[model samples]
Target: MTETYDIILRNGRVMDPETGLDRVCDVAISAHKIARVGHFEGSAAREIDATGLIVAPGFLDLHAHGQSVAADRMQAFDGVTTTLELEVGALPVAGWYERQATLPRALNYGTAAAWIFARKVAFGAIELDADVHPIDQMGAGSEDMCWSTEAADSQQTDEIVSLVRQGLDEGAIGIGLPNGYAPGAGVKEMADICDLAFQYGTPTFTHIAYLSNIDPKSSVDSYVRLIGLAGATGAHMHICHLNSTSLMDIERVVELVSKAQEQNLPITTEAYPYGTGATVVSAGFFMEPDFVRRTGSNYSNIELIRNHHRFTGREDMRRAREASPTDLVMWHFLDVDANDEHRRLLDLSVTYPGGSIASDAMPWINEDGSIYEGLEWPLPDQLSAHPRSSGTFTRFLREHVRERRTMSLMDALAKCTILPGKVIESCAPQIAKKVRLQEGCDADIVVFDLETVTDRAEFNAMNRPSEGVRQLLVNGQFVIVDGELETGAAPGQPIRREMP
Candidate 1:
């Protein structure tokens, strides 16, 4: 293996859940796959002498917003290898692919077939952008979601479906439903595309509406509806940030889901480990008067991020509220706690006996950089973005498993590795054990300087990169080395499904 191996990472605690091996070993890599994973005497072109460190399969970000070059840079340093961006903002799949030609990336790219946002752009209507019905529990909060665009004729619907089909062809793993908007999709459109996904054998990722801190109805209903959609269409459906919706009732939610699964709902989920949910405040609770009933405050108290108005005084707040009903406002709502009423939301996710974590991260920039205008003055992002952005893995190792002694290290790591890998493989078969590391897998691996590893981003101290993800390899290319991004090693490509 050494003779033909191109690179070898020697002497490290390798944790590969798929292989069920956790011990000190040397990993030999050749031709973009793991050549051997045992004691090695390798003479390779490049060698990382990983003595006393973690040599694990590289982590994949299930959903990321690495749209800009800078955001991609941050993700590499943060320990993300292959990322699928579902925030299908303004660009269609084809245009997004073309734009990637302009940036040098450190990981494999995948997309979501964006129905909601794309329709918003296709039709000049705002209501269609918000998927919530006017009578929904979260209807008042619909201002933040992409509403349904004006009703498209059958021809228009066909064209939109064609665009989504194009996205699937271009390597979009599946459909993305910001279901809070797009109620017009109802059961009909959902069945159509879900059937398409089932035919394609892909997944549909959902951020369901009425799935929030304050739904009088059971959030379990949202899960049931999604399960029904999956049952009807036969598409695998993934719920984003499931723990958030589960709130303090992990047992209840988990029990319901398990029962639904027993009934064959084809539903599954992933969550960020942090206690607090991260979203533009206005999007989730602010604009919703009903949410005001749930969260206890309206737009007046919601923290603003990148408010261009300077949102100087009380007058600015009143005027801006008058101007844009749907301005983007990022808010960090929950404080650190173990057993506060809503605080249990934080508890259930990380401590859940069997749950996976992800960083529901957005690109972090200065108040001016990321925010759209008049939206809301942004929060000073010491750690305003979700903690999972940088802290998900580390929090598990340091705080939960290692420090508190709640979970064993193996279980903690399993949540990070094999569980997510299985889910992604099931969701994105094209990239499956192929582009990522699984056997005949692309040698996308990460060798950690576990001794010094730490997540530096705090609620107020964001923009600080994680320390000691010493070496990162994406498809056998060295993107991070010795501690930082290696200059000029951008070999990532835009993955496509099969064009519509």
Candidate 2:
């Protein structure tokens, strides 16, 4: 009798980004790994007929912030197999990991050492709370902006570095430097963190310190600082959310990064296929007096997600921020749908050579201004969140690969899979088994129809999930089948580095 695999995905157009393989084939899964990939005459307890579907390695999201069961469900529709919190990660990394281990999850998850949270703790501003996610900490410094705008004294800097090192030692995949949130962090502080990362031979996921189109501490200056740190410390510097941060000056900044890459500096970039971005309304940069002028956006561009309220002036925005500093707001940096120039600027970042695609997805919140952490299926339609949380990956495939045809499907898949996996594999060895469809690799895969796959969630109706994922498997367990989510499935596993 032939050996029967656990599950078999047969007769699908199997596309492996790493091998450039795009042909009809069968993929066998057993023991949470790919057992075989070819015309294998194998029997399986469950077989998914994937005719006319694209079978590929599930996407790796290196910047996801939505870390709950609700967020995982939405991301599953977007074809994400692994979602990591690497931009602004968790503090007390061990506690964070411990907390996650106890919860049932749908997709694989991991976090980096959070620099912002370390500074908050070192500065004696807030207590470490494993339940309060890093996203909630964004505006927690609103009372004085101390964590966001105060330079750490030598003693405090030392303490901060020590905290970050502890997180890494506790198996954080990398370091999350949300420098933009704490612009007050001097060059020396950044260098110290980068040096620690170098010692560990890990990457520093960074949101550069500034975000303006012009000089005198502009986005260009920030990129220069990040690149300098990588060159000086010999650490990998991963730039997060390149599109929204660069705004209209993407061409100039991309040029600078390109030149740095040419010189072989350790740098990588990621961008979501959107013109707008979402963050706390009271973020550090929004408080700048020249914020509207620098970003070429006004108060009207910032809309509170809970109620769709747009501020009319600085005072209006300030009042809202002061009332509820942690409220999520949509910042429309570019009118991509209305302006051709804005669309092109966005394309520059999204389609950059060798760049990866990341969602930077936010968490789900109820209309009453509380986080929706309930384990509910078919998430409440009244819940609010950035559309990108549910649509990012599919949107990229729809616009770039199917609609525009600006790039081939294989290259696009690389952005979603292999490129992201390569970004952190140097530090997180477990990722080596992911992002591939060949034998011996982890069976983290997705099947979808190219023609019908599209993002249904928009700004007006943000709760709708994307529509293309036919089947999704994480660790060889089906979380989604026949375009439906398996509500009871809890197959997620932690993707962390081994502790010493």
Candidate 3:
């Protein structure tokens, strides 16, 4: 009897990072699971001639923030199937999940419990609204920067913990402690957060507390504090954006992290390929008097995306931030193209053994500097965002594997797929069935021509999606086929931590 499949990918270089299986084979999908791998004489309702293409598990982004239909479509072209908001996650987890359930999504989405947002609610600084992402409302508390700069008293700390616990109880994937966003959060509070993560058997995703290259609250100092917390609480601590946060002092910072991992302290890290990072212009660190000295970059490196305006100096940057504190800005921490040293610094983080490749992708915005919430296809021409949002996975493949050969095809795929999946699978067991090309895994796959797979999105034209994805499937449904987006398909599912 011939087995039947819903879809069949024939004669593709099927690569599974988990089992190191890289060879020409057929992949059969049926009922949202990979039905078979190897020779398939079976007929399918839809058949894709995948000759000369790479068939692998779709990439997983653990630090994604572009959680809209438009954003997901752009990422679909880049071969991503699962995007998790593990860093700076959402408050009121159940409400956020409920809101997302009503939207049409192109890729799987999930979020962690946001410590900072919980703080805002606990301090009576902001109202709870699941529809409002933290990035959109971060500036509302910027009047005094109290949420980022004030220590919570005993009662406030209790309230904050209670709110965060409620989110966890509601099945948030983990705890998100973006310490850099709130540097004044006391060690006691952080320790409490780590303890909760340990109790829940989940990881804590963090952006370290500081970013200065020099001491007295340097990146090194921050790493030490984070390592101590992990050790003291016996919790898994995952560092976000190792490249941008380490600045020029990545060597020292990586060494400290390496030693901690050597001692088996459960410290993990992720890095994006690009040196520039996107964030709110009014970030607390940007307001520091020695911001330029600390980051080793001048005001010109901070570019407002809406008008492409580069600040001439600190005052100019301050003026723009004061006017619209929540506006998105790109911070060019390293010029990888012009400087060999800067490029090497980025490579150190990106190629770090055991580190995953995550896109800390920002949301798209309109000309008015508002987040684009409409379910528009191809995105609006005037919409702007960091190129990393759309191109991180494809760009990594083109440069690291195909072009420079800095990483092997199999290794790079692991960084994008299995490595990231394993990071969160402990808490979100549903992810265990993803990020594999084996039979019985969820049928989330990407087929692309390796030779031509590259990012089209550049700094100047940030909205362009990547090229050369022949087919993309999420849960046995095609979001993109034959290099064109299926504008009507929305097969995305929620990836949440299982509740008791």
Candidate 4:
């Protein structure tokens, strides 16, 4: 007789991008693995009637930055089961992983070894603080500014490479290069990091060196350089947030990436669904005088995330940049007309073949400039954050797949799940089993009402959780049940790359 399973999801429209399975089926779970994927005669301790719901592999976010309990709760509500800080990764990778392991999390977590943080350590710009990750201390007035502004010499570069090696040895998923944040990092330094990734058979997740469309070093130039490095070193290169980085030039950027893939150089890119991009006002991105011309926007296009105040002129920008450099600001670059070229450009990135979807999520900060931590979730109304932190995946389903019909449901799910899974599995073997609904796979799943699933979080009220995600399971345990979050469930495990 078939043994009774721990849990069973019955009569759901199961979607598996990998096997191309989309049909009504019963998924049985026992312990942490999916036990079956068809009709089940045995009874279960718990059973969910999932009729008219879509059950797919939980969403995976490769560019998440909010690595806290509050952030995880928000992500779980959005149907994400795994989130990584691959863009601006962590420093002292081992410590970061250890610290997170001690906390209760609602979703799986991991990070790449951060080249920016490693460089800061080598330059003696940031001291190793066991209690705090270097990224937590980054502010305009902090010592991190030196690493972002000052070019590294040969000795310093070698030390940075050594630190990255140590992190890789400590089980980092890959290497993170936020070159745009560190403008002083030269081409040689960037190439060396790629070489390190190649040596370990891991990918380099990068926020490219330039964001502007204007020359001398345009966004196109940056992609060409990275593609060249990938071709030269055989390193898998994953570009972050193509829509924000490429702006209106995403078409040409996608063309270049496609061409590189055609030549068999392993390269991938991801984009969030929103039209606006968020970042700190004090970063090097806003320091250039040509920022207006390059981004095709002026002072009015910049709005403070904290207070929603628009930067009226150069003085307003200067005051914000100087007084509160770490404050979040939104750049309304893609918020154009519906039929405008900008919207088309944004759509192209989202619908690009095999391109993964990632949320470059920011953390929710309180009125006292503190981040919400340790199960203090459902952030207060006064706290501010980018909506992408809570809504990227849901928004993609609603706008692109449902409303515009730009992307089919299967293709969209593939982008959010299998595509990202393959990208990370190339480096982290631990995640190879995730992002697919199959027998013997980890039972990370999401059940939602397709007709009603949508993101409700807007810029001002960014903490509002997404609606219609009826249930979310991490490692076969429900973190969200019936549209409500289960605060005590901490079934999330760490995703790490095993050293060869």
Per-residue CA lDDT of candidate 3, range 311-386, in tens?
A: 8988887888889987999999998999999999999999999999999999999887888998776787899999
Ranking of models by TM-score: 2, 3, 4, 1
Query: Please, what are the lDDT tens digits per residue for candidate 1 over residues 151-175?
Result: 4556656656776776677666677
C-alpha lDDT of candidate 1 relative to the true structure? 0.60
Clashes of 4: 0
Q: What would the per-residue lDDT of candidate 4 be over residues 26-76, giving only the tens digit for each residue?
A: 999999899999876887999999999999999999988888888899988
**Which candidate would rank higher by TM-score, 2 or 4?**
2
TM-score for each of the candidates: 0.82, 0.99, 0.99, 0.96
Q: Give the better candidate number (1 or 3) by TM-score.
A: 3
User: lDDT of each structure?
Assistant: 0.60, 0.92, 0.90, 0.85
Task: Give the winner by lDDT.
Answer: 2
Q: Model 3, residue 105: what's the lDDT?
A: 91
Worst 10 residues of 4 by lDDT: 134-143
Off by over 4 Å in 4: 133-135, 140-146, 336-339
Greater lDDT among 2 and 3 belongs to 2
What TM value does model 3 have? Answer: 0.99
